[model samples]
Target: MSLVESPLLSIRNFYKKYGDGCLFCTTDSESENPYMDGNRCLECGTVWACRNLNFDLYQGEILGIVGESGSGKSTLVKSLFFNEEPTYGEMYLASYRDGEQNVFDCSHQTKRYLQNHELGMVDQNPYHGLRMDYSSGGNIAEKLIAADYSHVGQMVERAEELLEKVEIPVARMNEPPRKFSGGMQQRVQISKALANRPPLLLLGEITTGLDLSVQARVLDLIRTIQQELKVSMIVISHDLGVIRMLTDRTLVLNQGRIVENGLTDQIMEDPQHAYTQLLVHSLL
Candidate 1:
């Protein structure tokens, strides 16, 4: 289905569990309960990472996912990236498989191609998202390589273009990320993530560790990129401010379940769930 007619990406009844809660045995698992918290599972020494998560990301939408630590927001990102397989769920990208093929059922080769071309991720940790040892250009090149771009000059030119777009000096393309400040390192990561122009961009806590000033710049850069590229994005962050400023729609997860979902403005002004109310007030 076309993005205008259907979601660019859609997830239904998604679950990620661990230990005794493995996918095979989770048919009657308590983890499916929206109120089931980890402590409940931990008391029994199991882990229910995420439960019954359902959402839709419209084409070119910037959707925000917010929750406290251990709320499964990060787990959601991992599941989508295929870094951690879900116990059971169905995910579809209209850009691929007609939004009908179960992503989890895709073969390894197809999955790799999708990850490299259909999806891009800005990891929560710069170290995980970027190569510290590689020069800025090299880091960008790594992504290009995954997409099978082999022309050295063309890749370099594209790398410089992305760096410039992220406001990094093209001259510093040879500098290792280790020499850059935390903010600069994040910029490099953004440049690399966008190298292939993936249709869906997954952002994991992109601004958590930076100074206030740096965070503003990075968030601004993200906003600009989203507008210019018209890419749909799923942004995971605990900061309500981040969600308010960047996201058009918001999902509030609590203990692995989505407690609230609506337009960012509505959620902020009149949070429905108790947990979400507390979360919104704490930001005041």
Candidate 2:
């Protein structure tokens, strides 16, 4: 099925909790209520991550999810990408066939296709997503291998072009990621993730650890890549500044629930929720 006709992606009522809710009360199932237990705030409750979260993303648009530390931003991204399982709730992604709604309550066929072909992920630390010891070309080529590219030479050639596209010097393509600066390493990560041109790219604070100048450059590169590739992007970050630059629309997450959702400019200029207001101020 073509991506244009696909249902895109959706998440509904996703939840995750660990350990017994009570120190003394040991129960096998925490399913009585996925959000919380009977007696009130448990240890996990103290963290108070995502509660009854619902969100969606369509093709060719960037959706920014922003919140304070521990707001479940990272967890939500992880759950969508299959890095972590949701304790409860449903997530349906990559359901881009005709006559489908992309509901989380649907069958697993679409999800499997997404996991294998339609999704790409970038983490806060680019090194974590790449092989530091291998040459820049190696880091990118490995991904093509995983994606089942049979032509090794073609993969290397493609990797070289991607490196050039991300502004990495072609001369240094053979050098290991460890020798490159933080910004350069990130470019490699982006190139590797984009090699197959996945429909959805999940970016987890991809710019946070870099310096201000590097951050701006990487972010701009990402924007250019997104538009040129026409891929959907989901950027999860605590930095409102980064979100404002990358996304056309934003979802303000507070304690795992969306407090506000609107166009990025409008939401940043006139935030409706207290949490959104606070976040906007922090950016200022």
Candidate 3:
């Protein structure tokens, strides 16, 4: 009954299979996994990793995803954004105009447009997301170009403004991502991701590589920008300390399954799952 609550993004009976030797695929279906060779679903049992996984993300809410390596955090989030299609069940994204639509069922063009105008993602390493060869300004400008903003000059100006907003000085705009410090590069990545003013930002361990002070600044900057823009975000991190400070709600994941989901405070103060309790305990 409690699971029936509304969520901005909801996943039901979600399933995924990776590839040959990747357990995600082998066990889900009776037929031989066609796409790849010999991969298997990790869960040969009722639920090895994720089975009947259910959760909801509310608008303007920072939903923290916490889990150890190979916990299906990345897999599940990717599915939500339509980057990776789920094997069975459904995932929906709330649209401003069209209401909620199934992510996997949506047309490629529709998903691409939503990814541009409404969604943003910052991965574990900014290097993977940022164009290393392009200047910071160019990187930021590229999004606008992709969005078909006709006024390149105006967009460049806005890019500069965004660089400043993310704490990247104007002098560094001409520099490539390789020249920036990890923190600075991550900031530039954030700037580029936010260039189109997407309504939702999906961040996966984005601040992991930065030092404490830099991480603090980036966190503050994100909070500031989100408040100013009224943007919604989903942050995935292994650090409960960071999640406790940054998120409104938290989900605990282990071995590719969600063990706990609740308000951030509740999860932090009184964890229900053993994995969550262990994770919270390990936070510094």
Candidate 3: stretches off by over 4 Å: 1-7, 20-50
RMSD to truth, every model: 2.7, 4.8, 5.2
What Cα-based lDDT does every candidate model obtain? 0.88, 0.78, 0.77
Q: Which ranking of candidates, highest lDDT first?
A: 1, 2, 3
- lDDT of each residue in 1-284, candidate 1, tens digit only: 64457889999999887666533434455445443344244334466668889999998999999999999999999889888888889989898868889887888788888899988999988999988998989999999999899899999999999989988898999999999988998889888889988898999999988999999999999999998999999999999999999999999998787889999999999999999999999995
Where is model 2 more than 4 Å wrong at Cα? 1-7, 22-40, 43-48, 95-113
Per-residue alpha-carbon lDDT of candidate 2 for residues 179-237, written as tens digits (9 for 90 to 100): 99988888899888888778888899988779999999999999999879989999998
Under the 3 Å rule for N, CA and C atoms, how many clashes does model 1 have?
A: 0
Which candidate has the top score in TM-score?
A: 1
* Poorest lDDT segment (10 consecutive residues) of candidate 2: 24-33
Sorting all predicted structures by TM-score, with the top scorer first, yields: 1, 3, 2
lDDT of 3 by residue, 1-284 (tens): 68654556667777664532344444445354454322223334223344457777776778888888777778776766667777776767666334466666778897777777777788778877889998899988887877778797898898999998987889878999899899998888888889988878888888887999999999998889877987878898888877887899888877655678889999988988887888878877
Top model by lDDT, which number? 1
Query: Which should have the higher TM-score, number 1 or number 3?
Result: 1
Which scores higher on lDDT, 1 or 2? 1
